[model samples]
Target: MQPISRRTVLAGASALVAGPALARADRWARVVAAARRYDQLHAILVAHRGRTVVAEAFRGDGLDAPANVKSVSKSIVALLLGAAIDRGVVPSVEARLAEVAPRLIPTDAEPQVYELTLQDLVTLRAGLERTSGSNYGAWIASDNWVADALSRPFVAEPGGRMLYSTGSFHVLGAALAEASGRDLLTLTRDWLGDPLGIQVPPWTRDPQGYYMGGNQMALSPRAMLRIGNLMRRGGRWQDARILPRAWVEACLTPVTTSPYSGLGYGYGWFVTQTSAGRLGLARGYGGQIIAVAPDAEAVVAITSDPTQPARSGGYFGDLLSLIAEEVLAAT
Candidate 1:
């Protein structure tokens, strides 16, 4: 046998390293190409095993520029709840709204509302009439957003079926504010923003100046991926424990079901099965999503046009397909 030359040995080793990288790039290219077919999609980003596999902007803002995440704000609020629990600011998920923010609970609220826990709010199981969809305008028009939400008639029982109500999350945010003695913006900036190194611009606020929690928050696509990664890694970020692993697990545990999409609803996340593994999805209006596949070691974020709607039967379904079939497949 011929002795291999030093230069030839190095060349062979380089090819060995480059081959898998080239294949990964090609796969990600296909994923990006697939994403471009959606007119509403503004950006798609994917990170696998701590490395960014793809990041592309098709329209609207750049990947790093903040865009309206719509109801993904709900998911962020849920995360803040976890952080608050980790810091002992609000006790635990079992803490009752009446216990934490009695001032925001309207006197006319059903007696059962006082017994509702933080879990009920985060899981959309507060059993209150929904303020989302057609009721959104009237709810926001009220003088007191928290009181208005709390005053809604009982639609179910607390800890019952998912109501898909943004009002539930809004109440949760208000409770957090009352408990922490800090506004939503400050909590977000201090807990998630500084740790993840992302910007969270202030979004809408209620008449009483509490930041709206379930809608209108803004985050860049890159920032969304970081949030996904935080969950995917079980609440740790870059050597720091941003959230307790137990809290992350509990957050992803399915507690209810979304009536609109038929997906299992956890604490501020939608749970679904993917080819790769169980996915924890944070979705917003107009197709915005942050999908985390912990078993697959991948996280994907997509942002879409804020003005348009992406219903489950339409554009949102298409986005889910793209993530499960193309994006996760590549990862």
Candidate 2:
């Protein structure tokens, strides 16, 4: 091999810096230091303009180790749903859920159940009794997760309100698989993983062999950042259109205002207005997050232990917001 030229070395170094001059130094350092101090976070990945600016693994997890991304998996499922639609596997979001999975619906199902649509599930307005709040532990322990999720009684009129439910996304996953004649993991690998060069490991499946859709999906921090970056680029990876532009816009658009946090939630992402601008995020239980800010052309992924309450919203969200405010602000 020929000796490397000074110009080639400088070009390589320049590519490593994510964005403009400000992002190359103090801004990147501040984010790394803050995450270490506050959240005891396992890994942090920051990308700017489609390049890795800060990619560091910590807390005993290697860069390739898959981290359980909890509810952030919902966002991944959302991508699959969009891809399914684009491929003509599913007709449209307006399609009724009962029509898609008639076998799953009880013969004497509640009237509200009939009213639930694919759109309602994606937006978390399906009106099903939620599995996220008080019923979380029980839902996890149940052997027949899909049956248990579909068995929930209607608590409100479909499309009348928003209720956070992992079960809703689970149902969507099931419907997609049923319609496509492929398993959730297989569909995801074909639609997303293969195209993006991200490996989503063999996901945990229910007894029925359906991959769990809304939670506990495993991906490396780098993989998580790639997903965020895809969204940041309007669902296109490099030159290929992995998801439709319309679907991406719809997924990121706010559907309901959150009752607990005042943030806006869309299909599977949370929309928050911070000092840096509008930030779209996939927030998982226990402080795992993949935040994408289009205005800044930035994506940040973080993973932390969920059992630690202080680390959850207190440090994780704050640290990311601070990075946007203090670091990205200068840029």
Candidate 3:
């Protein structure tokens, strides 16, 4: 037998790394084929074990182009809340909303407002009458979004029912700013974007200068995948624990059940059961999704324009399930 040469040794090491790469490429080809078959997908990205298993941007968009994540912004806000809690700058979620935003409370406040807690907002059990559906556009366009949100009549007792409210999330953003004595965008940038190497654009701000917390945030598909991967890894990135493990667990637990889809909502994430198993995801309008399947050790992020009348189903959900069934199963 011929003795092994240095070149042969280097070739063997390269193949070891290339082995996974080639396998991933094959898996991605299937995902791309599925996306093409579906017809509305603009982008799809998949990651496993913190590695990019597949990334493809269809429909002429590049990876760097920012796509509006709509409600995925809510999950990012939840992370900010966790970071604030971990730093001891804010007290527990039990803290009264009146204590955090005294201005929003009427001087002769209703008893329900006094009883409301930060936890209520996070859990979507705030009991305020929600303007979350058709009225959202007008509500967001109002001159005083926070005040307008607060003006909504109370439908039930505080913490009594699960009412999906974008207004509630906006209030949470305001509360965080009040408790930490910093603007929401600055705090988010310093605590999250800078640390994670994410480039969050200057998001639309309310008339009061608070970042629009409930919706209309932009992120690259890769950034969305990164956030999902972080959640999959239990709030740690590589060696650093960026968020509290306990808090992350709490974020994944179901706090309220969704009337629209029957899935459960926790903090900002959505908990649902798939054919494969239980999973957590952040879904946004127009088919943007950040799906984390912990059992499969996979995260898939997709951005697409599903609002088009021709393509008006849950394409993101369908595409993700297919990827889980086909590509992930192969691995």
Candidate 4:
């Protein structure tokens, strides 16, 4: 009696057409080999020039089931911020935290918190004491998510380093709601879900009822593709422009370097260096990834063991091989 994910509502067309594109040159054979071997992998979806290339599910989860995308939601949040900016719900990224939501700020917070802008939170460089890696559990269990985030001690200057904290994004999500006078759910549904023809189901919420900002969002594999296509197509879905083009460009332009993948970190995406071109991807914990190869005009979405690790040199490296050696080589 759980709420149905309703993923089957969207997989028919992709399943039908995916066979042909994957069959050519045994390109899909490599993908099949990898899928069958990795018990952790659940789905691999690749699309080229607006058509489904490979849409195959391995074992753990069905292709038409919703999977926990974890931190990939961070990228989606970035997109929502962009749309909000377009509509003037919030000013540009340069706008300070005090300007956006002074009411949400803690009266006893360190002075540095007031200096932060929307840009810092999106880039994961808020310089707050870390709340993501070892601190994630305690941060979420706090009575007030926004207050706890704002009250964290500063580890560096406002824009100095990438602290990679979920608290930063969580606080920013509350700030966004305060600035727009609209909840995050409404903004997401109206700006993205409706235009892309995808469903945005409710997921985990902090104790105060704000949606978990940077992690724990769920989506069907096909829905992930729709999001990648939205970015690949420069924030447009068909004739309707979902996110502003300028925002798309700005998100891809690397502002800081990542210590995790040793890649360029844009707004929320982890930008990688590839022989083909700059590979901009929405990477989550485990092997959950949405890779967009703009040079190849291709988009690939992957969902794997969300509970397992997918570091750059291990399982994640193999996944990237499928994209670089198999998917891109075929092209």
Candidate 5:
């Protein structure tokens, strides 16, 4: 019989420890391979059953440093709204903007603007002309962002159409600040940053000092994945409740549909069917995203080029394909 060597015993123990980890990696190797294909892909992360399956950084400041997540901040804001409501800072989504923050309504603004609910704002149905895309420049460049947003001409009746507008969310952010007596920045850090152990860095502020909402948030891929996990796990993280489960459910459920992407729009999430089952997407400009598939017990986060547009079947669609075709399939 061979001598019982210490090195051999350690090797056997190491193999025992590595066995499960190696298997987990192998289970998602196809996803990792697919994620690595994009040159502009900043970072990609995937998790399953409360375990991290893949985390890779490519173009952005690695995984630890913050990358601008663009409009995915709207989803983060939605999470804060849930926490605020649970804490009684906000009465409900039905709270009218006029009652909550009457001062923000421009003097000559459309009467409907004064009646916009928090629901209307977060759901991008404020009925105001969009304050994003080409209009975003002038909107942000205004002297008073809140008033400027409120002053936009009505393109549809309040709650009539899903007009994607950052201004609506900006006003919502301001109202959230006034309601909670804390700026969106502080609320975000307290409600989400501390709970998830993720850094919520200071983002661009509006002219009136309100934290920019629905856009220009900085979160690392690791932090973004933490958020994704919080949502995928139904607003709980490690047994600590962050968001009301009900709010998370409603956000994941579709309330409207996007004309461009043909995806269902919930509060901050875009709902669509994928091979991975019913997937809810928290998307942003330039492809930043948090894709949560409850049925698959998986969450995937991606941060892409902040400067470029990621249209469907274009670069951003490739990111979705990575999740729909590869990650979900691998699972």
Candidate 6:
């Protein structure tokens, strides 16, 4: 065999290191080009193997500007519940609503409402009439949000099919507040924002002064990316164990299925089987998404116009296709 020159050896080693980096750059460039097609999108951030590889802002808000995350707040709230459990603020998922926040229950609430558990509320299986969609205005307009949610007639048995009610989560926030002797914002800041090193700006509050649970929270795209990365890392950040690994794993396990998109509903995430991996998505109104693909060790955060709808048949579907085809494929 011929002896190789020192210059030749150095060139070969450099190529070996640069090859994957160049490929990643090429793939993300394609992703950015495809993302521009959607006028609603504000930003897209992707992190691979625990480091940010791509961050782009196309319009509207800048990548670091806080934008309304809408129902993605529900996912964050769910994490708070897990943290509460870990801290012994609340007992466990099996704890009954009436047991924890008995005063919040309305006088006329159905008998089954008292039996509703933490798991039921987090999973949207509380069986209460939905306070989302067309009924949202009236529910929010009510004199007392927590009472209104509990007083709603039972549309199904507790722990039945998913009802997709924001009211359930609102009631949950109230209960957590009552149980912990701390408000939702305080809990969020202490448990999540401080740990993840992200800002948690105050959002909408109900008539009784409880922070809205399932909607209207604000976080920058970068903040959302940190959250996704925390989840991707099994609820840890650096040296700190921000969330229990078991709790994070539980959040990934399917507890129910969403009726709207046919995706499995975990603690606060929507579960889906994709070619790249088992995707756990924290979705919101408009096109906001924080997707964690554990199999690929990839986390993607997307923010869009909060005022517009991103239904399954429209813009949201396009976002999913973009993640699966370009983002995950690159991983």
Best by the lDDT measure: 6
- Candidate 1 lDDT score relative to the true structure: 0.91
TM-score of each: 0.96, 0.89, 0.87, 0.90, 0.92, 0.97
Stretches of candidate 3 above 4 Å error? 1-25, 106-109, 306-313
Model 2 lDDT tens row, 234-289? 99999998999888877788988767666788877888776767788787877788
- State the displacement of the C-alpha of residue 58, model 2, in Å, after optimal TM-score superposition: 2.4
**lDDT value for model 3:** 0.78
Q: Candidate 5: what lDDT?
A: 0.86
Ordered by lDDT, highest first, the candidates read 6, 1, 5, 4, 2, 3
Q: Write the per-residue lDDT of candidate 1 for residues 1-331, one digit (tens) a residue.
A: 9999999999999999999989988999999899999999999999999789889999987998999999999999999999998898987899998888889988787889879999999989888899999999999999999999988899798888889888888889989999999999999999999999999888899999999989999999999999999999999999999988987887777877787888888889999998788988999999899999999899999999989999999999998899899888887
lDDT of each: 0.91, 0.80, 0.78, 0.83, 0.86, 0.92
Residue range 1-331, candidate 4, lDDT tens digits = 8765557645756766776655663776675676667777889888888788788887657766788998888888888889878999888888899998998888998888888899999998888888888888898888988888888888878777777787887887777778888877777788888889888888888887788888888888998998899888889888888888889877777888887767888888878767877778888899898888878788888999888999889998888887887777665
- Model 5 lDDT tens row, 45-97: 88888788788886778878899999898888888888878998878899898
Model 6, CA-based lDDT: 0.92
The TM-score measured for candidate 6 stands at: 0.97
**Candidate 3 structure, TM-score to reference:** 0.87
Could you tell me the lDDT of residue 298 within candidate 6?
96
Off by over 4 Å in 2: 1-23, 310-313
- Top model by TM-score, which number? 6
lDDT score, candidate 4, position 188: 75
TM-score for model 5? 0.92
